[model samples]
Target chain A: MVISPSKAAARIRAAAVDAFASAGYGGTTTRDIAARLDMSPAAMYPHYRSKEELLFAISFEGHTEALKVVEGADRPGEEPSVRLQELVSTFASWQAGHHSLARVVQYELTALTPEHYRTVVALRRSTTRVVREVVDAGVQSGDFTIPDAEGVTLALMSLCVDVCRWFPAGNYTNPEDIGKLYGDLALRMVGAA
Target chain B: MVISPSKAAARIRAAAVDAFASAGYGGTTTRDIAARLDMSPAAMYPHYRSKEELLFAISFEGHTEALKVVEGADRPGEEPSVRLQELVSTFASWQAGHHSLARVVQYELTALTPEHYRTVVALRRSTTRVVREVVDAGVQSGDFTIPDAEGVTLALMSLCVDVCRWFPAGNYTNPEDIGKLYGDLALRMVGAA
Candidate 1:
């Protein structure tokens, strides 16, 4: 089959993500990524300038997608507790569901170039800001009581983000179960009744 | 000064742990580890057979040390709330305090042989059991009103374990501060009064 450049690029990216997720950013080589996609290293080079660039691509895109998920999970005019649960559930579920991509994006931050690292950090801060603001609002409205909104928000994010570290597919609990459970735990952490 | 064999071994292990933490297991080489200790690669091999063995040594020792920290944190006859606080604060602080070693141990599990991985996992499970039993006791005594002790325990551990991933040294927050805050948050998480 004659594949277009965009299609070829997409295949190379998909293979790279899987390779990096399985073998880790440092463990994966461009040759391994190309091997998975049945392409020569020369063919892969056109789509990605280097392995670091490929990692940046996956890390950047994955984190950006995660930000979108959290931003979309928030609702206007909803009770803060209700909003908080939805946000945690949706965010946790997405992490558990797309764990491979999540692992690379979350754990492989050290491998990104300085510019890419800063950009990814900004996206991460935005996500953290979203959660913290929701939490701060909840505390302000008396829907939640927290000693430190930023710390609690970090713990909440940690709880959700760590799901990708341990929750593999075919585990006893599925992503939905984890989401619901984390949502409940998050509410309790925030002192929401 | 001529270093004794045991002292050389210790230095090699220490250097290996640091290299693996910064460069990752796959990216780090025996030469790098030896370079840090001012030894040739050939001299390094007499102490450690391969890079994987060094990684296994650091990982195994790190996990074993973590188990000791958690196990020691539990004080018999204490209230679950108090016990949980101590457990988390000590555990989290250790992770923060020994973050360079902690990072290699926690993040580089895939590099371990299956047997070594299982051994590390057993230590991890025992640590989890210690926390869960404490949480379960709290719930049974009406001291905590958690929905799922197991899930809550995991979340609690996650909150502590993840501090290593982001909290570098010289940051505004110290290990003790994180520990104190997480301890307070854990109490809040379990609905402790």
Candidate 2:
């Protein structure tokens, strides 16, 4: 059976994400990713210009998915409190569910090339903007008694993102449980009740 | 002026902590550490065994300091709410103030050898134990209303540790502001108000 270059590239990307997530971008090499895919490092060059390029691809793709996750939670004309809850629940759940990819996307920003780093940071700003907007809405509606909307927003985001750092998959409940727990906690943090 | 081996070792460790915090563990090299200290890589060997050894030292030291911070926050016979406020205020402030060191300690756990990793993990548990104890005390005293003590503790911690991840040294207010914000946020998280 012959594999097309696109199939090979997809396989390479999958392997690279896993390797980078596990060993970190600096610890992972093109050779290790190629070995995981049963391809030569030379073959990988056709798919990704360099290891950093593969990392940029993974980081870019991960942030794009996160943007989609948070955007999906935004319902037009929804109440502020409800919107904030949905946003935290969906976004935190995504972080926990796709933690391996999330780890690299969030933690390995330092490993990207300067231009790629700027691109990913810009995408991240969009996610941040969506979150801040919801929090601001909550504050304006008096549904959330937040002293500083920006600080509260940062706290909620940190709470959600840290799920990727320590959420144990097999030992505890699933990502939805975290979503609900953090959703409630976020409301509390924002003085919703 | 001749530098003693112990002094040189200390310099190397300091340099390693900063470099690892800035560049990450995998991205930093022994040569970079040695260069920062104006020592040869060969000269560095006489002090630390390897780059990983230096990383392990920084991590080990950081956790040790964190343990002290939390333990110091423990005041006998204090109310749980007060204890928790102090505990989080001090701990989170420490994280923000020494964020460079805290970053290496928290994020570079993956780079340590298994044996070194175990040591750091154990120290981290002590910090966790202290925080959980305070939350549990609050719950028992009816001073805090939390559905899941463990989960609430985790969220509170995630809020605090993340200060090191994004708190800019030259940014708004200071580490004390973050400590106070998180302390209040923690209270809100547990339904203390």
Best by lDDT: 1
All models, DockQ values? 0.63, 0.61
* DockQ of candidate 1 (2 decimals): 0.63
Docking class of 1: medium
Fnat of all models, as shown: 0.52, 0.50
Query: What pairs collide in candidate 2?
Result: none
Task: Please identify model 1 stretches exceeding 4 Å from their true place.
Answer: A169-172, B169-172
lDDT of 1: 0.86
Tens digits of lDDT, candidate 2, A1-193 = 9989888777888898888777777777899999998888987888898988988888898899999889989985998778888999999989999888888888888878899999998998899889899888877788889868777887888888878887763333589888888888888888884
Which pairs of residues clash in candidate 1, taking residues 3 or more apart in a chain or in different chains?
none
